[model samples]
Target: MTVLTEPGVDAAASAPVLPAGPSQNARARRGAPSWAWLGLVPFAAYVILFLVVPTVLSVGSGFFTEDGTFTWGDVAALGDPVVVQTFANSAGLSLLTAVVGAIVGALVCYALLGMNPEGAVRSTVDAAAGVLAQFGGVMLAFAFIATIGIQGVVTVFLQDALGIDIYAGGTWLYELPGLVLPYIYFQIPLMVITFMPALAALKPQWAEANLTLGGTRASFWLRIGIPVLAPSFLASLLLLFANAFSSYATAAALASQGSQIVPLQIRTALTSETVLGRENLAGALALGMIAVVGVVMALSSLIQRRAARWQS
Candidate 1:
């Protein structure tokens, strides 16, 4: 009877549970396909080396003193006007770009989803969008330069043939609009790619049902379609903002100076007299970008959760 007494909690805690199902368990336990994870290694390494490391270094560097000693001035200077202004500009532009790109992209995807576009048209459009979305930084800047530079084909035509003095009175090449040209270029493609999945999730029967229920097209779209698609749209938009705000080469290629984006500021700080101190500034700026991206991702997740709740 004494031997039959149960052991302590630690002994019971060592017990294992039965498998729920062959197909339902997680990959590690169920011996599921490893392709996804196997493929993820290189991609993950790239992200860790390039993106994550840089981000951590930038944020941590801000807290460390120039001589490898640490201080709070880096964190404390988070409130600097120039720092504040750069973030404000970045946040505002990112928000604006995300919103605009999301709307336009969703609409475009929706239109395409409904359309049975075939062959050349579909391939051509897909190719073009892919190129634009994947294209950024220096390559995009150079493309913009080639298309609309001082001696660019379009610029030359606009100036010489049309006698348009846009470059004369308005050097579109060295201004906010110039930066916007590339932003819009990349932003639209991001929206298009991000929305494609959501659009695919859109069941035509849902639209049909709504319309059958005496709901007008606009009402169905406003009440139903948008609610479902909002998360994807917002996520993509935020991504666009992140891409645009983090972008350095394109902006640098576009503007000689005075734009003063936070990333560019960080790059400039690298070459500053107080390079050590400025690296901290650069770190703070990066943390700000991460915060922006985090906020956007969180918001989209919330929207998705709310949508699910409403559905349930």
Candidate 2:
């Protein structure tokens, strides 16, 4: 078994050589044509045009008069009693809907957790959630009106069948209180869509380990499950809150009699000539919304990052 090799060559050179430095994928990416980055151009342009430009215009308008003269008057509208009350109403509505939606949706996710991931029920639910999450606006409002409005099918049925008066006090369905049901309607589906993945990411081994240590089912959830999912739950809650806060069409359609929330208030500011010398007030309200939503989304991103560590 004599082996011959060049005297000057290193023996290690003949050994199975491992590629050094960057990976094939990395090198291929590095060598890619510069034109490849152009794929992002359309998306970047879209964001700049739709998001960046509108945000800047909206925020900037808040500090200027209708004549383009800079003034703090418009900004001061944020402190107005009416504006403040509108914001409070919107926040309260959003909070209520978010909490309700998160709890109900979390329960739904838990129910689905033990089911086959690809089963008929799960598939149908996933499809329905995806659709319903985006199912707000005038169409939803119209559906509600057709089903439960004054003289509508359900209203008539309840009045005739059970002697019930849904509107005995007043037309609550066309008021601020009315927006709650519709807001929660879409919020639940959205919560389900966002929170389900986090639920699915919970490793079965964690539960097994808890049981191995002589933990009861209740104890396992209280000690391990709740702590692990808390971040994700909070993130989804914030997301739902933001979704509800920014909702306009459903509220607009249902509560057409008054500006009861921030979005509707903005609509009033833009449409009404009664509020003289404050035409730019809508911009101020918009800025307020942007600030609130921005803070919430930032918090959500941070919590999502924490939750992702365990999933990864």
Strongest candidate by lDDT: 2
lDDT of 2 at 47: 99
Note the Cα lDDT for every prediction shown: 0.72, 0.91
lDDT of 1 at 251: 82
Candidate 1 residue runs with Cα over 4 Å from true position: 1-44, 117-119, 256-259, 273-277, 304-312
**Candidate 2 lDDT score relative to the true structure:** 0.91
Least accurate stretch of 10 residues (summed lDDT) in model 1?
Answer: 1-10
The clash count for each model shown is 2, 0
For model 1, what is the C-alpha lDDT against the true structure? Answer: 0.72
lDDT of candidate 1 over 1-312, digit per residue (tens) = 223325555645565676777566665565755566787899999999998898788777877866878788877777888778877776666667766776787777876776555767556766788888888878888888888887788888887898975577677767765676678777887788766766677677888998889898899879988877666566566667777767777787777666467766777666666445466677766777777777766876676565454344
Clashing pairs in 2: none
lDDT value, residue 273 of candidate 2? 70
Consecutive 10-residue window with the lowest summed lDDT within model 2: 13-22
